[model samples]
Target: MTGIAAPGTKVAVTGAAGFIGSHLVEALLGRGCEVVGIDRRSLRSQTLARLHLGDVLDHPRFSWVEGDLTDLNLNEVVDGCMYVFHLAAVPGVRSSWTGFEDYIASNVVATERLLRACREAGTPKLVFASSSSVYGMVDTLSAENDVAMPVSPYGVTKLAGEQICLAYAKRPDSRLSVTALRYFTVYGPRQRPDMAIARILAAALTGEQYTIFGDGTERREFTYVDDVVEATIAAAGVDVPAAVINIGGGSSVSMIDVIGLAREVTGNPVPLTAVPAQPGDVRATAANLSMARLLLGYQPRTDLRTGMTRHAGWMRGLTPHLLRTYAPPPMITGPKEATCSH
Candidate 1:
């Protein structure tokens, strides 16, 4: 159960075209892994050129499967793989309330299908990209053993996916070693256009109004993307039968403070619009990372300011067309880890 993605290690990643997924693919490739990726989105060459994964297209060991998870020939995507990272899902909290069916299909059904594929392929390690949304509103730092009382349909679906993983891991006939990391507000360069930090940064560039849902006091444990990716890869190698770990950003901050940091990092002021908080939006989220430290040897390396500085640099590198993809959000942001399935 201890494999650190050595040279020529065969790995499979779902949602390879997404923000976090793309980063994971690159990290695996850097480790000399032979990677097979599957995503529902068709990655055109030109579009790929505009995103984080353009160079991966030409790598000798990299291949991609472009199709929905439920319909794809999953054995092609997963067979012979030593590790399978399941990161694909329809993200966002409010949207899930309006489009619960899509959430169920992608997060729940698609996950079940991937689990079955891994079971049949006899994949050694399955790392599931879960979320803090599964915790819902918490009065203190949420830990792995806390009762899951998700307040959003999206959270419910994510919880269902984690439950399914736990069930499969406990099954008598299963050979899967499961590690589900509950990511708390993952952010950095290449964040989805819909996420809070992405919008907050984009608003600085576009001069558009960045909506602040609720007062600006809503706090989130914003773990950097690189930190999350490392924790995930580490989990794949860690010796554990089945475990859930929290990947936190190392610190917590309010939305207002984040906005201020964005302005400081970019040196550009963004107009802010305050609005009443919508349903399913938690007042705050924090993580107790004792398990992460002990289980995966995880410590969040990037703080908000440094991570935001890198994010600003990334945004500055994008062309106007590329920047268009980082369009201002209609609302402020979604749940923590309102990501993946990019």
Candidate 2:
């Protein structure tokens, strides 16, 4: 695969301040594409905050726009940009149960708005950041072809967003070549504070007790952030009309193994608490990435242990609050607690 973009290929990335979004921006910059990043959150991650203050956005080839995806001026951002990487959304399956409206607006309505704007603007290609949670709870070995019975409102909204992309791409005179990359458990440096393995293991490293919901049996294919970014960039450059491809690390690991890895990575034996599983919690998820392999020439090179260690190392330098290890409140018994347990 050609890892470099030709000159003058401006790329627009939504959710640019986010974990996945920031990585995508960095990747696009490395590939020599002039980038325009749009996001609402500012100074969330310290690394990102450093990048923010470093005037990276002020580069001759880089620009930053601060706004919600649904409310942004799409034409201005989309102008002169041939590739759009849509990663902005209300995240977490459990959060959707209590806040369905946010999910609807951010995940579904925002995507629809973007698709409409792209259609109107004649953008040539768009790569959507989708979630594997659309599969929800399923039998072991969940594949792309399996029925997508999303158990969470977030999943439903994401699935709806993918449908919107495909439907928009199918327009008779559409200039868009849309591809939805369903990511599974993305983790690495700058992982969100609420993510599962990172939170659990990072807490252990800081001498904090962590809660393990659902007896640690739930399994997931935790793709590294870098791999997901690679796949996203690949999908964006592809000429495929409309495709749904799984972006995963291609291996399933249980919560127990994640805790074990955390212990190993942290070199600390932390206290643990067991809680009942919350709503929208899945039993297991494993992506069959054959479609992505054939279409995007994608390969996941980072294993969970290695990725977790990298996150742990990065977390060590940040404040304990970012790791959720700094004197956190009692275990949250609410439904939203289990939403991000990848």
Candidate 2: misplaced stretches above 4 Å? Answer: 43-55, 319-329
* TM-score (C-alpha, index-matched) for candidate 1: 0.95
Candidate 1 lDDT score at position 110:
92
Which sections of candidate 1 miss by over 4 Å? 1-3, 45-50, 331-342
Worst 10 residues of 2 by lDDT: 320-329
What is the C-alpha local distance difference test score of each model? 0.85, 0.79
CA displacement after TM-score superposition, residue 56 of candidate 2 (Å):
2.9
Best-performing candidate as measured by TM-score: 1
Question: Which 10 consecutive residues of model 1 have the lowest summed lDDT?
Answer: 333-342
Per-model TM-score, in order, reads 0.95, 0.93
What's the lDDT for candidate 2? 0.79
The digit string of per-residue lDDT tens for model 1 on 1-342 reads 124647999999888988899999999999899999888887775473237678698899999888898888787679899999999988887777676788899999999998988888889889999999999888899999999999889899989999999889889887899999899988888888878888889899889887777888988889889998999899897676788988898777898899999999988997888877777888888999999999887888898999999998999898988787786756534443233211
Cα distance off (Å), candidate 1, residue 158: 0.5
lDDT of 2 by residue, 1-342 (tens): 443369768888888887788888877887788998888776545455454335456567778888887788888778877888999988987777887888899888888888888888888888898888989777776667788888888889889999999999998888788988889988887776677766676668666667777888888889998888888877876777898888899898898888888789889875788888888888888888778888888889888888888877877876745445332235887976644522
